[model samples]
Target: MSSGSGVQPKVGFIGLGIMGQHMAGHTLAAGHELHVYNRTRSKAKTLVERGAVLHDNPGAVAAASDIVITMVGYPADVEAVYFEAGGILDKARPGSVLIDMTTSSPALAERIAEAASERGVTALDAPVSGGDVGAREAKLAIMVGGDGMAFEQASPVLRTMGANIAHMGAAGAGQHTKMANQIAIASTMLAVAESITYARRAGLDPDVVLDVIGTGAASSFLLNGLGRKMIREDFAPGFFVHHFVKDMTIALEEAARMGLDLPGLELARSLYDRLVSDGFGEEGTQALYRVYNAIHA
Candidate 1:
């Protein structure tokens, strides 16, 4: 739909995981007609109680929505949701907007955009950052890529879910931007874990050290937030470890395609690989602290 159409879009959301549930809630709370679906119907129950229409599958959600947002797990899951039989593209209205907010492959985003265009649907790869806290607080950073006009039409709804929203460029640009985000975060996560571990090993109070360093040159959201989580040994999934590993792999693949090598990113990916191999895939990225914690313990 065009910007300034003065119509509230029917919003459909898929993947009601840790982040998506809160995002859909914000949209509903903002007065959109909300439709939703998830593999586990129980996840949609809370939204359904709050006036969202529950659909059984992706295609049904698309049919009922003027704009559809997806926040599924892996690239393969993204493909299955959009390309498999009875998918979003199959049922989306001609002018409906399709947004994939999952952190995924740039190539996959490009493919979805192209396929959506073929169906007269506008698709944006609008991946997000800020984890569960940001999702819950409506403070996410949304990087969007696709049609500029479509981005404008989608911005009001996006603002319900994010404070920092930008139109990066054409198709797949958002995912590329997110890859850059993940690359920077990968090394920082490693450093945050190492720093806190070092503090404990040196017999310093890690929390006080965090208070000191977190205000100085070394401060960041990861340092302040996830570092605190680390100190408490809270390994819950704000952003899952397996998902971070997937993001790192996608970033490294993109880097390899450009004939570039990133040693830090590679090293971080390897450590996360260990976490996944050790069956901590469902845990938060901060669980990396456990590796360091165990070594020093």
Candidate 2:
């Protein structure tokens, strides 16, 4: 339904985690009738109070809505919520749209698309980046994969959550694009961590170093945002290390399938694995700085 047509579509949102919660809020604020479900009932309290319908499960949400969007964690969660016996696919109306915003396997995205098609539903894999801050600010970058027509139909809804939304080919392309994004972030994270460590070891104030370098060619979102967080030791989960590790694993597996070797991604995965082993898995991706600190110490 067009946002400008004065017909706000009924929107279903599953997964009320850090980013998803804010995303659903934006959708609600945009005048859509939002139906929300999360594993944790308490997480949906505010949304429910604000007029969002609370559903018992993903299926219930899908059954009651025109567009179902999932931003859950993990491929397994995506699979369970969309393909299980009582999942979205079973309950969503024939003409309803399904958007999986979770960063998941391209294969799974393709599978979901195929299954949705057989059921007369339109499915799109539209994974997002920009972290919790982006979600909260409604400025995420959404990379979508599916029919161009479906993308157009979903753009108004997607716009409420993201500033940059692009249709990148069909079925699984968004996920493939997300994998590339994770690969680049993997190496850049290491660089950001090491640069901070290097500055501190040389007795230069790391924050000052960041200020200078942040204005130059070396500047980047990671360098300015996560970089400052690293310096401040703010390890809160804008994007969890556990989640980043999962993305890295997916990228590495995809690379292996294509006969590609990505040492940077491999190294990042290994380092994040180390953090997970050390009980820092729940921390933010910026916690990779802890690895450098521990090694240096």
Candidate 3:
């Protein structure tokens, strides 16, 4: 199917989680025919109501579209949607483009790309950042890796959902970029938590400390956002602790495969493991502040 530019790309979106919904919405808003699928059909109802066509299965979604984008939870889920009995790849056309937007492992991304290539489908490992807020606001940061032509073909659609977009390299580069994103986020969260805890124990107003330091060289997403959450004792999940921990494990695994060590990332992973062991796995990544709370308590 042709898009508005005479090459109307009929797009299929799988995964209707915190991010996928908004990403898919952009396609529909851009005058593209969008077919959406989700394991939970109920989530797709709203999109359907908004004029997006909802398919009952992955295959149906794939069959109806030219470009298929997936933003499932993890590597396993990616495989399930693309390689399972009724996976999208089985129905997607020979020249169709498949982009995996999940922040999965580079190894898994590479394997999927290779699989897609064998069947004559172009695949891109395009993991995203900017969090849930970014998705909702159509301001995500996207890192893409795959065939250059495929990236170019997907960029306009991608740009609709992201504020920053980069072509990292060949297949799996986006996931590798995301691993670095996760590592930095994981490490920063731990450091910010520790800093706020020390500030509070020193009898300083944590908010004021954040206000002052958040403007200095010490500022970061964690320092500004999580710092406020820490002072208020809010454990609400911005990004879940469970997901961050899993990302850390993938990073360390990749590091080992490359015969290296990511000490800072390893340290953050340990802290998250401890948080999970204490039954905080379901809490927000900001809940890492609880670890420092316990230390001061």
| TM-score for all models, in order of appearance | 0.97, 0.97, 0.94
RMSD of 2: 1.7
Number of colliding residue pairs in each model: 0, 0, 5
Give all candidates' CA lDDT scores: 0.94, 0.94, 0.85
Runs of candidate 3 exceeding 4 Å displacement:
4-7, 295-297
Instruction: List pairs with backbone clashes in candidate 1.
Output: none
lDDT of 1 by residue, 1-297 (tens): 533477789899999999999999999999999999999999999999999999989999999999999999999999999998899999998899999999999999999999999999999999999999999999999999999989988999999999999999999999999999999999999999999988998999999999999999999999999999999999989999999999999999999999999999999999999888888889999999977766322
How far off is residue 137 in model 1, in Å?
0.6
RMSD for all candidates, in order, please.
1.6, 1.7, 2.0
State, as a TM-score between 0 and 1, how close model 2 is to the true structure. Answer: 0.97
Ranking by lDDT: 1, 2, 3
Q: Summing lDDT over every window of 10 consecutive residues in candidate 3, give the lowest-scoring window.
A: 1-10
**Candidate 3 or 2, higher lDDT:** 2
Per-residue alpha-carbon lDDT of candidate 2 for residues 263-293, written as tens digits (9 for 90 to 100): 9999999999999999998999999999999
lDDT at position 169, candidate 3: 98
The digit string of per-residue lDDT tens for model 3 on 83-132 reads 98768778887788899998888877888888888988889999888877
